[model samples]
Target chain A: MATKKTIAIIGASGNMGSAIAKSLANAPYRILLFGKEEAKLKSLFKEIKNTNKKADAEIIGCAADASWEADIIIAAVPFAAEKDIAEKIRQVATGKIVISISNPLNETYTGLVTSSDTSSAEELQKLLPHSKVIKAFNTTFAGDFSQPVINGKTIDAFIAGNDEEALETVSDVVRSAGFNPIKAGALAVSRTLENMQSLLIQLSIKNNYNQVAGWKILHN
Target chain B: MATGILLFQSITVILYYNNMYEVLFENVSKKIGLTKEEEQLLQTFFIPKKLRKKQYLLQEGDVSKYLAFVEKGMLRSYTVDEKGIEHIAEFAFEGWWMGDQFSFLTGEPSKYNIDALEDSELLLLTKQAEDQMLEKIPKMERFFRLLLQNHLIAIQGRLASSLSNTAEEKYNQLVQACPTIPQRVPQHMLASYLGITPETLSRLRKNISLRK
Candidate 1:
């Protein structure tokens, strides 16, 4: 077998980060789990190991170190921390796939924090010009990772990236995590995906779905 | 080293036992014949799972992901009322299939709970897998249609019985259909399935024995 691809998850202690890590535990990938809180990272690592004894994962102290050794870097931190993390890992993340999974929701949770002109993913792309920035998983809730099939329908993960190869790679990762990957077009499409998630969040709150709702496009 | 080898051998045996699909193949063969190659291909579509007694296969408020065919042991589907009284919907024995069909078909949250009544082995197939299977093997399409027809007939009969039959008549009909069920299931569960109290079932059984 060929050598497994390495994926570094920044902010691996956070809800989305840990959920993604757990989802990919059984997949054929080497995982580098990093977060600001050392203790949380340690517990997350232990949790992953407990679930899958053969998980190829380890806790790393910093994002840059993890990104340097990784083929794919997932920025699982909040939208507010995206620029700070981009600056931290800019040098090493060049020529690698950097996935932006943050949604820039406003304080009221009724709107986007970012201006209507550009998305968090598009901004991240501008910040790390050399890295292939792909937007994905923002439309999905963290709880859906463990059981992506809601009502017998697999949840759809909308992916957007300028690089076709990067988009395909991210689609494969999303599929491996038990979601149906829908290529929602180029990096600019991330704006629409983010807005879609904001609407879904609002609806879930108003309707009492308890954050278990997800998207599934039905077609002939 | 000897103990380790014994442990490894036991695990291997368990794995081999779990992978056995003979029961599923036999059930399918009764409906339609398949070539050895087709059987091998068909095996890929199903996922084999084991549930200990009392383990839930499907729960209320969750979507039914797979339709399960019982290979061994028994399972029961039930719903709890607002007062916490369980109303048994149906029971699935060996060679029978069970699922929340409404939830599975419509992609909605189920109002039913399916759980193993005994330590059970089942072959589970998802809707996508079923569609692909029918596409690959046209013969399976007939098998499934026949299965659905039979299921509908049974359901209609059950509905009629629930509405019109006496408790005694219902118990007798159930026994006539599944002779082994009375022995396998608890009295209260059988009563619940008949939509009657346990005391009524007990009295009915006693009266029937006296008549015999």
Candidate 2:
């Protein structure tokens, strides 16, 4: 029997981080929940264990400062802490697949923080120069990750990275979670993805969509 | 002969309105295939208005009541910084939509100002009319959603460039995106659009020519 791959989700106590952790819990992989609050991490692990009881997967919880031991690390922390986490985990993240779901939205959520030419994921990659960074899940809401299907439609997960292997690894995980993983070119494409987050957030707040809406790329 | 001339004048008037509505319908249809009934319903939702040069469509501190779609001529949306310097946020010419998204969406007082650069013809849609149109034609929702998506992308890109890119790079990008903007807009307005001083823009242009 082959050993299952390990996936660590940083800031696992947060809505987006925990939702992704819960969604990927059923996959044939070990889930490690990392966060600053130990109690919150433990509770999130418990919830994941409760919901994914039938799935053959192991789960663990640890602090943000803990040494990471995973094949893939998802930095699902807030945009403000992205650089700090990237800098902290740079050593352990080396040669590992790092996925960024942080949207560089301004504090008010009305606009983006990063420039249009760059993205949070790209900044993370620069911080963790040894890690292969891939941008995914930034455009998606935490509300959709629990099901990956909304209104009987498969939500599109726009994945972008310079590394092909990293993209495929993340895409396979996304596919396992019941989403249509869309390869949106390179890591720089995260600019568009993050902007899409701002747009979705604005639309939801103003139009009363309740923050549950997901993007679906309709093609003829 | 008088009746014939009156008939010709009426035909011209019909063609003029048809041309305006035609451009709008074409813009909407590019996203979703709208039925003839949906198109007509969509047309009824818009209130046609014309603004002379330097006339305001939306002013700061006023709630943006309508999203204006330009049928002809140009309009510019701008803001005044703390220093009382005008900064161009967006420039809308033919087939483009203009309004403060925040104000239009939330019915809040606008921080931006939208004014006509030339005598401009626009089709304005209020939130109430938009709601009725969406109810009558659900496909219109998709059109608006796509519009929002595209708008988001463009604004995000602009924000990103302003944050990180050099003034020279920004200038090159603006030129690449709309090659004719410099020719159509005044130097000061173009400088404001680039978030740079007119003096810097002149220097950049001079450097480019010198390098050539």
Candidate 3:
């Protein structure tokens, strides 16, 4: 058998990270969990183990160490922490796919903190110039991950990356996690994908959706 | 009539239970000795499935969730290119294992398609189940490691032969390895596997027999 690809989730104790981890628990990848809070990481690891005894995962203490060992690194932390995490793992992340799922929402969650000119993934690509930064999973709410389906339709995971291979890889990961992956375009298209998420969050708040809302493109 | 039907079904079940598990156990025994208890424990993790001829075991774009151990009959793995030409990858007879290892290990879509060439019985092992079995029986882990090593060697040898051998030499090697393949698989399929035309394979066969 070919060796399993290792995926490092930098903020694995957080809502988005844990959700992604749990969804991929049964998948064949070797997952490396890294979080600022050791206790939270431990509990999350335990929970994952309880659910699936065969989950190949390790609770890594250092983000850089995890990034160094991983084939793909996911920056699952908040937008504010993405820059710091990027700096920490910049050298290790070179030539690897760094997934940016952050929306960079401003306080009150009304709008994006990133200027209209650039998306969070574009900024992350600048931070780790050698790493292939792919924008994905930003439009879907954390709560929606558990089901990834609404009214018999699976959620659409819009992915954007400068590297074609990186985009394909992220699309595979997204599909494995039960979402319908839509390859939006090049990394620059992340600007629109990120804004789409901000709009979804705003609409969900304005209504009473309770974060259960997700994006799905209807087609024949 | 109902009683007769019930008796027939029961007999079929009994035969299935005896043959499939026995084949798997015998195969494992060839690699490493297993105690009766260990044998019983190992059986719990495998799921027995049957496929009719031409039924797909796996398809392109689907993740291979199980490593199938052939208990009876034959199966083949192949790929269809962009132009829709089918390229045969490997064939599995009884006691052989078949799977898209990359897809099975990484949860990625397989490029190959596996389908039964004959009515077949298979014992399937999922990644999770295999892990539990290995943890429960460390000896099985060694057995698997040896199996993998042997598989690797065979694949490497095949790669070398494919690169260096002529079509006739390749056919000779294939028949030397599995003498029954020509009779078991369709001629065209065998020709495809050897990267030759059916006409060439027929010509080669006639020449080989004439030489003999």
Candidate 4:
């Protein structure tokens, strides 16, 4: 049998982190979970194992020993902690495909903390230049990750990255997790994607979108 | 002659009502599986209304009484700035819903003014009526929720465009998303919708044509 690919989800206790873990519970990959809170990571690991009885993939949880050898690293940390987490993982995550879902929304969320010209993904890329960074899942709510279909249509996950190879790998991961991955463009396009999340958040608060909604691209 | 006019009006009203029901039934059924009986039940809450061209469906100080759904023609919702310049927020056409949600929910004075761009047909449901319908038919709640979700997604896209895109890019995106918008809406209103001056829109159009 071929060796299973490893996907390391950092900050695995948070809402987004846990939701991604749930979506990948039965996937054909070794799920490596990392978090500051050991107890929470252990609990999530147990839940993933219980949910997927036919699970052949190794599910490992760690606090100090972060898995650097994983094929993919998901930065599921909050926006404030994005820099800190990236700095911590920079050396270990060198040359690996890193997926960022951070939205640099201001405290009020009426605006973005990061400049509209550059994105949170770009900022992270500057911090860790060696790692191939891709922006995705920022526009999707945790509620969307719960189910593949909303109103009988598959939710579209828009992704942007500079590296063609890295984006293709992430697209495969997105498909494995039951979403239609849409290649939006290069890494610079993350500005639009991140801004979209801020806008979606504001609309959700003002109009009661309630996080159950996501975007879908329909082709003619 | 007066009697004949009345008879014609009655038949037109009947046909309009049937069209309204058909649009609503299909829109709701596509989202949530609805039976014919449930669609009939859903039809009772809507009250049909007509607006002549330039007629105001809602004004700034009026507490919005109904969530208006468009069955025919176009309506524009906008707000006037302190300088009396209008900023168009949204345009609703066939099978679209438009209302001042804040005013409808809170009974407060609205900041928006909605006016018919053409002779328009509308179906209105008050908050109480909508609530009662949802209580009677729970599936309709899902339908409305999905509708709001779609609207939110579109609004988010517009917001993103405004924040990051240039005027020309915004115009291109708007046309790409709604191909008929530029054809149906007047250029001035299109400029307003894009948050640009009419002159800028004209220049952009000239530039685009020159490039072609």
lDDT of 3 by residue, B1-212 (tens): 99999899868645645565777888889989999999877876765555658867788888898898998989999999899988999999988999999999999999999999998877778787789889999999888998899899989988988899888999999999899999999999998898899999999999999999
Task: Identify the leading candidate in terms of lDDT.
Answer: 1
lDDT, candidate 1, at A62: 68
lDDT of 4 by residue, A75-139 (tens): 88887898888755654454567899998888888878887689889988888776789998888
lDDT (10s digit) by residue, model 2, range B1-212: 99999899868756645676667888887889988877765666665555658867777888887798998889999999899999899999888999887888898799998889998777777776689789988998899999999999999999999999999999889888778888888999989999889999999999988999
- lDDT tens string, model 2, A125-197? 8897757799998878888876678879999989999988678889998887778999999999899899998
Candidates 3 and 4 compared: the better one by lDDT is 3
Docking class of 2: incorrect
Candidate 2 off by > 4 Å: A1-3, A54-67, B1-212
Q: Please give the CA lDDT of all the candidate structures.
A: 0.87, 0.80, 0.86, 0.80
Interface RMSD, one decimal, each candidate: 19.2, 29.2, 17.6, 30.7
Better of 3 and 4 by DockQ: 3
**Number of clashes recorded per candidate:** 0, 3, 0, 0
Candidate achieving the largest DockQ: 3
Highest TM-score: which candidate?
Answer: 3
Instruction: For residue B115, give model 2's deviation from the true position in Å.
Output: 70
RMSD of each: 16.4, 25.5, 18.3, 27.2
Better of 2 and 3 by TM-score: 3
